[model samples]
Target chain A: MNANDPILETLNLVKEFKGFVAVNGVSLKLKRGSIHALIGPNGAGKTTVFNLLTKFLAPSSGMIFFNGVDITGERPAQTARRGIVRSFQISAVFPHMSVLENVRVALQRRLGNSYRFWQPENSLLQLNEHAMALLADVGLETFADTLTVELPYGRKRALELATTLATEPELMLLDEPTQGMGHEDVHRVTEMIRKAAVNRTILMVEHNMSVVSSIADTITVMQRGSVIAEGSYAEVSANPQVIEAYMGTTDTALQGAH
Target chain B: MRLTTYVYIALAALAVLAPLIGLYPVFVMKLLCFAIFACAFNLLLGYTGLLSFGHAAYFGAAAYTTGYLVKTLHWTPEVAILGGMALAAFSGLIVGAMAIRRQGIYFAMITLALAQMLYFVCLQLKLTGGEDGLQGVPRGNLFGMLSLSNDTTMYYFVLALFVTVFLLIRRIVHSPFGQILKAIRENEPRAVSLGYDVERYKLLAFVLSTTLAGLAGSLKTLVFGFATLSDVHWSMSGEVILMTLLGGVGTFFGPVLGAGIVVALQDNLADKVGSWVSVIIGAIFVVCVMAFRRGLVGEAQAFFGRKKKTA
Candidate 1:
C-alpha cells in the first residue's frame, strides 16, 4: 500500500433494513495513525457505519477496503483476525471471567492457541505477565483478579479496552467508549484513549463533545446517514449544516425530556 | 492435596470395597454407567451452556451399535465399545453442525426433534429389533482375555471406565480450550470480536460429550446384557436433564451425585410405590427447584463459600 493511501476507505456504503434505510450511500476514509471520531445525532447512522466497517453487518451495496484490499464479504471473525477489532457500545467484558483472564483470552487468540483443548490452562500462565502489563496500560492492573461483572462501570470499560488492546489490533473501533459515565470517568477514559492511540489508528463513535474535541485529530459529522461536515474539531463545529443538525436534534430531545 | 482430591480418593476406596460389603455389584455397575452419562451431558449444558435435549440419541444409538456388533459379529467387548463410540461421534458431528445454526430454545428444540427422528428410524430398522430392541447382547470377553460375563468383573470394568471418563472431563474443564468455551458461553459476540471461532469450538465440545455418552451406553449394554427402546426414548433425554439440574449444572461432581440419587430413587421406589414413583420424583423436582435453585452441590458450595469468606 502507498504511504498516501488511507488505511481504511469506504465507497458509497448503503444498508437498508426492509423499507427503512439505516445507512445511505455514505463514503468515508481514515488516514493512518489518526484518531478519527464519528459524531452524529440519534438515527444519523454512525453506528451503522461502524457495524458495516467491522463486517458485523454487510452493506447492501458498497465496498470496504482495509489497507487497500476489498473486505466486503469477510465474516466478523475473519475481519477481526485481519486486525480490525471492535468494542461493543455496551460493556462487552465476559462477566464470569476474572479481569486478568479477560485480557489473556484475547492474547490467547492472538497466539492462535484457542484450539489447544488438550493442554491445561496452566500452560498459558506465561501469558499472565503480559496480560497484566496490558491491564496496567489501561489502569486495570489492581482489578486483575476481580470478577469482571463486579467491577464499577468505568473500570469495566477500562477492562474492555484492555481486552481489545490485547489483540494488538491494527485498526481499533471503539463504539461509545465513554457513554454512561460520570465526569471523572469520562476524563480518565479520554486520557486512556489518547495514550492508547499513540502508535495506532482509532475510529471512535463518541457523543461526549469535550472528550471528542480534546483527542480527535479529525472529526466527521453525520446527519441523516450522510457525512455533513469533515475537518478538524473547530472546522466541523463551526459548519452551518452540522450546527443545524445538532440544534434540530437538541430541540427534539428537549421536547422529549418534558 | 486439595479437599476434592482427598474426596475422590475416598470415593474410589469405597467403590472398591462395595462388593465385599454385600452391596449388589450389578446395581452399582448400573449406577456407574448412568453417572458417566450424566457427566457427559453436564459437560455440554453446564460448561458450554448448550442445552441439547437429544443426548439420548447418542446414548441409545451407541447401545444398539455395540449390542449388534457383540451379538452378531462376536467382536470383543473393547472393539464393540470403540465402534459404538465412533458412530456416536459421527452422528454428533452432523447433529451439532445443524443445531448450532440457531441458539437457546431453538437449539434445544432442533436437537429434540432430530433425536425423535432417530428414535422413529430405530423403531423401523431391522438391526435394532424395533420395539423389543436388540435383546440378550452378550457381555463377551474383555479384549478377548478377561471374561466380563461375571458380574464382579463387569463391575470393576465399569468402575474403571467411569473414573477414567470423570478424570478426563475434569482435565478438559480446566484446559485452555475449556476456557474459550466458557468465554463463548458467557458472551458470544465478544468472543467473535476476539477472533475465536465460536461455532467450531461449540461443535467440538458437542462431539466430545456425545462420544463420552456413547461410552457410557456401551458399558450399560455390556453390564445389563441388553439394549432397548427405553434407552433411545425422549424420556431418557429428560431423565439426564433432571439428574444434571438436581446435582448442579456446572459443578464437577454434581452430575455423578445427581445420577446416583436418581438411580437409587427409581430402584427403591419402583418396587414400593409402583406408578407413584413418577409422582414422588415430580414432587422432589419441584422442591429442588424452589428451595435449591443452584442444585445440591451448588448450594453446598455457596454455604461453605460464605462461611470461608466470613472466617
Candidate 2:
C-alpha cells in the first residue's frame, strides 16, 4: 500500500520511564482496513506503543496522526471519541457486572448517556437490543446473563472484544487477543478478529507467530524500541534480520515456517 | 440476588415501626445519623476503593455549622441543616481535590490529618464555644409549624432524612457514574485507557462522600439540640470507620446494621465501662479486621454464595 493509504501514523514516537526508554524512535503506518501486526521479543515495547497510540501515555517526542488528524497527547477518551479504541493484554473487564451490563455500559458510554440518573437503562428496549446484537456478534449471547467473572477465560476474552467493538472504533488496537488460550480458543479468536476486520482496522501485538503469520497483512518487527523490519508476512519472513532477531540466525529465513 | 427490593421493604417496615422498637428515640436518631455517615464513607471506600480516615472533618464541620446557626444566629432548623450540607460539600470538594492526589494509605492519612487540624481549629474557635461546643441549641419548628420540641417528631424527621439520603446513595450507586466508579476501583488504569477521566471520578466520589458525612453530622446536632467537641474529635472519626467496617463496606444495608449494633453497644457499655468504651470499639475493629473481613452482610453473602454454587 502507498504511504498515503495510511489510516494511523506515528512519527518519531518515544516513551521514557525514569530515564529508561520503553519505546524509542518508533515510526510505523497502519493502512486502512488491514491487519497490521506488531511483533517483538519480550520488552520490545509493543504494549508501550499501544499505550502511546491510545494516549494512555504521553510520548516524550512524537506525533500521532489518525485519519490525518494530529492526536498527539490527547486524552484516551478523546482519542477513543475520534474512533480509536484498545483492548488490554490482561483482561480488562468489570467482573462484578453481568456480560450484558458490561456491554451496555460501553454502549452507554458511546451514546454519552451514562450520566443519566433517573431510569434504569439496562432494561431499555433499544439499548438492550443493541447490546444483544453485540453479544451475538461476539458469540457471547448465551453467557449474557452470567457475571463476566463466572465466564470461562476464552469467553471473557470474547466479552472483552465485544465490549471494545461496542465503542464503535474505526481502529481497534488489540494486544495479545489469543494469549493463554487453548488451541480451540486460539482458533476461535483468530477467526473472530478476521471477522471483525471487515469493518474496523486492526493493529495487534501478537506473540503467537503462527497466528500472526496467518492473519497479518503486514508485519513490523521491533527490537530495542525500534522497528528492525517491516513488510508483508512473506517478505518479512524472508528477511534474515527478522530471523536472527526473532528466532536466532538461520541460513534460510523461512526455515521456521515448517 | 435482586436484594434491593427486599432491602426497600425492610426499610419501609423499619420506618413504620421504629417508635415501637423500644430503643430510646434519641438512641434511634443517633443510629440513623451514623448510618448516613457510613453510607457516605461507602461511596469512596466501597465503590472507589479510596479509603478516607478524615471523614469526621466534613461530619464535624456540618455539626458545628448547624450548632452555631441554631444557637447564636437563631437560624431556623431547616436553614441550619442546609447550611451544614453546603459547607460540608465545599469542605469535601477542597479536601477531596488535595487528598485524591495520593492513593491508598496516603489518601487515608491526608484525610486524617486534615480532620485532626479541623478538630483543633474547632477546639479553640470562640463561635464553636471553645470546647463547650455551642450548647443548648434550640429545637425550632420543622417548617415553622409542628414543634420539634416533641422527641417523636424529631426522631421521625431524622429517620426521614436518613432514608432520603440512603435512597439517593442507592440511586447514585446504580447510576452510570457509579458503574464507572466500580470500573475505576476494579481497574483504574484500564478505565483511563478506555477514555475515563479517572482523577475527576475520584474527586467527585470523595466530594459526595464528604457532603453526605456532613449531612449526617448536621442531623445529629439537631437531634441532640447541640454540637459538642465530641462531633469533631478523632475518636468520632474512628467510630465512623468502625461502623463502615462492621457494616460491610460495599453492601447497602451493612452500614445501618453496623451502626445500630455499634451505637447500642457504646450506649450500653458507657455507663459500666466508662472510658474503656474506646478500647472495646477498638477491639471490635481488630476482630473484624482479623476474622470477619466482610462484616455482617458480606459474610452472609459469602455463605449464600457457597450455597448457590452447591445448588
Which has the greatest lDDT?
1
Deviating ranges (above 4 Å) for candidate 1: A249-258, B1-6
Residue pairs in steric clash, candidate 2?
A77-B195
In terms of docking quality, how is candidate 2 classified?
acceptable
Q: What are the per-residue Cα lDDT tens digits for candidate 1 across A171-244?
A: 99999999999989988999999988988999999898888888999999888888889999888877777777
Candidate 2 wrong stretches, greater than 4 Å: A1-5, A117-125, A252-258, B1-15, B20-22, B308-311
- For each candidate, what TM-score against the reference? 0.96, 0.94
- Per-residue lDDT for B12 in model 2? 80
| lDDT, candidate 2, at A154 | 92
Model 2: per-residue Cα lDDT at residue A117: 43
True contacts kept of each: 0.75, 0.43
For candidate 2 chain B, the 10 contiguous residues with the lowest summed lDDT are: B186-195
lDDT of 2 by residue, B29-58 (tens): 888899999888887788789888888889
